[model samples]
Each structure stands twice: as C-alpha cells, then as structure tokens.
Target: MSIRANLDVVHERIARACLKSGRDPAEVTLVAVSKTFPLERLQAAADQGQMVFGENKAQELDEKATAWTSSDVEWHFIGHLQRNKAPVVARHADVFHALDSVRLARALDRRLEEENRTLRCLVQVNVSGEQSKFGLDPSALAPFLEEVAQFERLRIEGLMTLAAPTDDPEHVRPQFSLLRSLLSTPAPGGNTRLRALSMGMSGDFEVAIEEGATHVRVGSAIFGNRSYQ
Candidate 1:
C-alpha cells in the first residue's frame, strides 16, 4: 500500500476508535514517526497532507528541519533526548515528547531560553515499568512536574509513554490507562490540567486512542518499515 493509503486507513481507525469512546476525532493528532526514514518519504507524506512528523534522533531532526523550511511542516522530537543535543532540538522541534528528567528539562529550558523560544513538551512516563524504556517512573511523575514547572520557556503540554512491546494490543491497555489516570493528580503548584496524552505507536494506536490518547505516533503504518544503515 502507498503511504497515502496507509494514512487513510489509520485515520479511519482513529475515527472509529474515537466514536467507540465517545470522543471527537479532532481530539487526536496523528504524528507520523519519520525516524530512520528518508526525507523523500517524509516529503511524500507531507504531500498527502501530513504536517506533523516525529524524529527519534536530534541530528536527523536537525538535518530534516534544515532542509524543510515550510512553516506548515511541524517537527516533533520524540526520542530520548541527550543533554548535549538539547540545543538542536530546542531550535527546531515544535514539540519534545521524551522529557524524562529534571536535569534534561533544565538543560532544554536553558537552550530554549537562549534561542528565545518556548517549546511545548510532554513528560514521558514508563507506564509498563520496562527497564529498557526511557521515561520517568510513575511514582516520580508529580515531583517531576513540579520541578518542570520552574522552566519558563518549556510549556508542560501533557504526558507521553511507550507501551511495553507485545503482540496482543490488549496487554498494553493498562499502561495507557495508568498514564491517563496520572494526568488528573494535582501538581505541586496547582497546575494539573494537562491536555495531551502522547501515547500509542503504529501497532497499538487504536487501543491508545480508545483510552484517551490525544497524540499518536505512527511510523511503519504510514511510511512502512524503517531501513537502518
């Protein structure tokens, strides 16, 4: 299937999921995960009306951002960001999805301040308690949010998480639900109205959408399998 065809199917699935959950389809944003894919593939999706693209590596994101100058094309840095690469991400990404530490948050905040820009960020949580995943533990989320609030340039948009990889999508439902439940817990400074849940990937996005995912990151479903050189 073509990228456009795959995107159409994904959109249809999202709509059905939203209908099942009594939510508006507009509440969900499809972030095509373009990480490890070529720029031409991204451009192909863009031509099909895809505006938001996610990259896992800061260097790849920077290179793509440098090449695609369209104001309509919004880039999201959805990888485990390193502190040293904060400057590149701060300069080019419209949204940072894997903010897991206060130290990284402080680093990104400083860089955003230097660039004179404010970035919308989602605090990533390791809901499945997977040792291999990169996110804050559930118990540490509230304090992390409190500390994150101190950064003026980084707007705390909401939460993000990668469900433990499993063949059955039902196995990951609880993880998504847990992340949703944490959003309502009041932060230290009484700011707890988070509006986005950046959960779900190509395989489990439908389930994530049903469980209240505002943003879904889909890669292979849209662009097909990635090629690692």
Candidate 2:
C-alpha cells in the first residue's frame, strides 16, 4: 500500500480504538517509528503534519535529525542506549525512551548538563522479564527512580515497557496497567514530574490506550515495509 494510504488507515484505526475505549482520539499521540527509513519518507510524513518520529539508533537519529533540521519533527530514542552514545543521543533526541538503568540515566544526565539542555526520559522496565530484553528489573525501580530524580538535566516523564508477544489481551493487560500505575506513584526523590506513558506499537496500541499510553509508536502500520532500512 502507499504511504498515504497506510497513514490514513492507521489514523482511522487509532480513532476507532480510542472511541472503543471511550477516549477522545486527540488524547493519544502517534509516533512514527522511522528507525531505518529514508529522509524522503520522514519529510513526507512531516509535511503531512505528523510531528513525532522515533529512531532506534543514536547515530541514525543524529544523521536524520541533521538531514531534516529544516523540518519540525520531534525525535524519540526508542532503542537500547549505550552510555558512550549518550552524547549524540542527547544532542538529537527530544525524548529518550529506552533509559534502562541508573547508569544510563546518569550518563544521560551528565551529557544533557554539558549541552545545557533538558532531556525528557522514560524509565524502561522489562516488565515481561524476557531474557533478551534491556531494562531495569521491576524490583529495582524505587531506588533507581530516587537517584535519577537528582539529575536536573533529565526530567522523568514516566515508565515504558515491552510486553512479551502474546495474542491474549488479558495476559498483556496487567503489564501495561502496571506501567500506567507507576506514573501516579511518587518517584524516589519526591519528583512527581512523571506524566508520559509511552507504550504499545502496531500490534497492541488499543490495549495500551486502555492501560493509559499517552504515546504509541507505530512503524509498519504507518510507513509500510521500511523501504530505506
């Protein structure tokens, strides 16, 4: 299908999902995951007024953000982040979505301070505990939130998680719900700035909305097969 066609269908789906959950469709923001897509596609989406896009790699984000600097697209870092890449990632992204540990958070904190910019970040929790996933163990959340709260350069926006792939919505419901609950709870250092719940993707965004996902990242559903990647 054409990109425009894909976008239209996805938009309709989002609306339908929101209506089904009794939510105003305006409450949810759709982020196009442009990880390996070309600049042309990114520009096309931006031109169409789709303001938010996500990239999974630091270097890729750096290149895309620079190449498309003239446009007004918001960038999100949605992949595993390495400490060494924090500098470039912080420089280019509006929000870092894969902040998995205290170490990564500290690195981002220092980098943002150096750049004199504030970074909005989500504490990635491997709620599913999949051995291959990258995130802070759920048990370590309290103290980690406390330490990250001390960083003035980074603002805690709330929690993000990847649920194990399963067809049963009931099985996945609790995991997304838990992440939503985290936002209302106080952070360790008394920082209650958490407001964003970035979760869900093409396969399960309706579940995410019902569980309170303010932002949902959708790639193939919007951009098709990721031609440039």
Candidate 3:
C-alpha cells in the first residue's frame, strides 16, 4: 500500500478504537515515527497530511528538521536523550517524550533558556519495570515531576511509556493502565500538568488508545517496515 493509503487505514483504526472506548477521535494525535526512514519516506507521509513526526536520534532529528523545512511539521524527540545531546534535541524538537532524569531536564532547560525557546516535555515512566528501558520508576514519577517543575523552559505536559513488547496486545494492558493511573494522580507541587499520554506504538496503539493515549507514535504501520540493509 502507498503511504497515503496506509495512513488512512491507521486513522480508521484509531477512530474505531476511540469509538469503542467512548472517546473523541480528535483527542488522539498520530505521531508518524520517521526514524531511519530517510527524507523521501518522510515526504511520502507528509504528502498524506501527517503533521507530527517522531525521530529517535539526535543527528537524524537535526538533519531531518533542516532538510524538511515545513513549518507545518511538529518534531517530537521520542527516544532516550543524553545530557550532551540535550542542546541539539532542545533546538530541533517541539516535544521531548523520554524525560527520565533531572540532569537531562536541566540540560534541556538551560539550552532552551539560551535560545529563548520553551519545549513541551513528557516524563518517561518505565511502566513495565524493564531495566533496559530508560524512564523513571513509577514510584519515582511524582517526586521527579515536582523537582522538574522548577525548570523555567521545560513544561512537564504529561507521561509517556513503552510497554513490554508482547505478541498479544492484551498482555501489555496493565502497563498502559498503570501509566494512565499515574497521570491521574496528583503530583506534590500541584503540578497536575497532566493530560497527554504519549503511549502506544505500531504494534499496540489501539490498546493504548483505549487506555487513554493522547499521542500514539506509529512508524512501521504507516510507512511500512524500515530497511537497514
């Protein structure tokens, strides 16, 4: 299928999921994960009205943002971002999804302040308790939010998580439930800036949508499988 055709199918699925959950389809935003997919592929998705693109690497993001100079595109840095790469991510990204530490937040805030830019960010929570995943522990999220609130330029919009990969999407439902629950709970500083749930991906976004995902980062579904060879 063409990118446009694939996008239509994805949106239809999102709408169906939203309908099933008694929510507005408009509430969920589809972020086409464009990492490792080259500019030509991005152009294909963009041509089909995909406004938001999620890039996982710092260099890819910087290059893509420069190459695809469409003021319409919203860039989301949806990966583990290091402190050293913070300045570059801060410069190119409109939303930073994996904000797991104070040091990374501080680094991003410092650069945003220098450039007179404010970046919307989501606290990445390791909901599945995977050591390999980079996010704050569920127990540590509220305090982390309280500590992060002091940064002037970074707005802690909500929470994001990558559920444990599974064959049956139902297996990861609890992980998504946990993340939604965290979003509802009040933070220490009354920093209840919670709304968006940046959960879900190509494999299990429907389940994420049902669980209350505001932003779904879908890559392979809409653009087809990426080739490394």
Candidate 4:
C-alpha cells in the first residue's frame, strides 16, 4: 500500500480507538517515526498531511531538518540522546521525548539557553524495567523531575515510554497504564501537570490510546519498513 493509504488506515484506527475510549481524536497526536526512511518517504507522508516526525538519532534529525527546512515539518528527537550531541538536538528538535537523566537535561538546557530557544521535553520512564531500554527507573521520576525543573530552557511536557516488545499487545497494557498513573501523580516541588503521554507505537497504539496516550509514535504503518543506509 502507498504511504497515504497506510496513513488513512492508521488515522481510521486512531479515530476508532478514541471513540471506544470516549476521548477526542484530537487529544492524540500521531508522530510519524521517520528514522532510517528517505526524504522521499517523508515527503509522501507530508503530502498526506503529516506534520510531526520522530527521528531516533540527533545527527539524523539535524540532517533531515536541514534538508527539509519546512517550518511546517516539526521534528522530534525520540531516541536516547547523548550529552555531547545535545547541542544538535536542542537546536533542531521542536520536542524531545527521551530525556532520562539530569546530565542530559542540563546539557540540552545549556545549549538551548545559548541558542536563545526553549524546548519541550518529556521525561522518559523505564516502566518495563528492561535492562536494554534507555529510561529512568520509575521510582526515580519524582526526584528527577524536581532536578529537571531547575532548568529554565527545558519545559517538562510529560512522560514517554517504550512498552516491552511482545507478540500480544495486551502484554504491554500494564506498562502503558503505569505511565498514565505516573502522569497523574503530582511531582514533588513542581507543577508537573503532564499534558502529554508519549506512549505507543504502530503495533500497540490502540491499546496505548485506550490507556490514555496523548502522543503515539508510528513508523512502519505509515512509511513501511526501515531502509538501512
């Protein structure tokens, strides 16, 4: 199927999910994960009215942002970002979804201050407790949010998490629920009224939406599989 066709199907699913959960479809933002896909794929999705794109690497996001240069194409840095690469991500990304540490947050904040810019960021929580995932432990979120609040240039938007990869989407429902619960809980010493829950992907977004996901990052469903360079 064409990218536009796939997007229609995805949007239909999102709408149905929202209807099932008694929520507005507008409450959920679909972020097309465009990492490893070519500019042509992005152009195709953009032609179909997709404005938000998520890239996993800072370098790739910088390259793509420079190549596209469309003010309408809002880029999101959604992968594990390194402190050294914080400057690039801070300069180009409109929203960041994998802020898991104070060091990384400080780095990004410093760079944003220098650039005279402010960034919207989601604190990533490792709810599944997977050794392979890159996020802060759930128990540490409160203190982490407190520390992060000190950074003036970084705005704490909400929380983000990657569910445990499983064949049955139901297996990861608890993880999504946990993220929602965290978002609802008041953070210490900060008004962390998280408005965005960046959970879900192409395979399990419906379940995530039912559990209260405000942002879903979908890739293969829209752009097909990754084309490695």
Candidate 4 lDDT over 104-197, as tens digits, reads 9889989998999989999999999999999989888888888888888888889999999998999999999999999865665343557799
List TM-score per model, in order. 0.97, 0.93, 0.97, 0.97
Q: Write the per-residue lDDT of candidate 3 for residues 1-229, one digit (tens) a residue.
A: 9999999999999999999999999999999999999899888888888989999999999999988776899999999998999988888899999998989889998999888999988999999988898898989986787888788898888999999989999999999999999987576543348889999999899999999999999999988998988
Best by lDDT: 4
Q: lDDT of each model, Cα atoms only?
A: 0.90, 0.83, 0.90, 0.91
Candidate 2: regions farther than 4 A off: 167-170, 188-192, 227-229
- Position 54, candidate 3: lDDT: 97
Model 4: lDDT of residue 150: 86
Q: What global local distance difference test value does model 1 have?
A: 0.90
Alpha-carbon error at 81 in model 1, in Å? Answer: 0.7
Better of 3 and 4 by lDDT: 4
Q: Candidate 4: lDDT of 30? A: 97
Give RMSD (Å) of candidate 4 vs. truth: 1.2
Candidate 1 local Cα displacement, residue 79, angstroms: 0.7
> Candidate 3's error at 189, in angstroms?
5.5
Give candidate 4 regions above 4 Å deviation.
Answer: 188-192
TM-score of 3: 0.97
Candidate 2 local lDDT, 1-229, one digit each (tens):
7677788888888888788889888888898999888888887787777889999988999898887767567899999988999999878889888887778878888888889888888888888879998887877777778777777788787888888898776688888988887776667544437788888888888888888888899998878775553
Pick by TM-score: 1 or 2, better one? 1
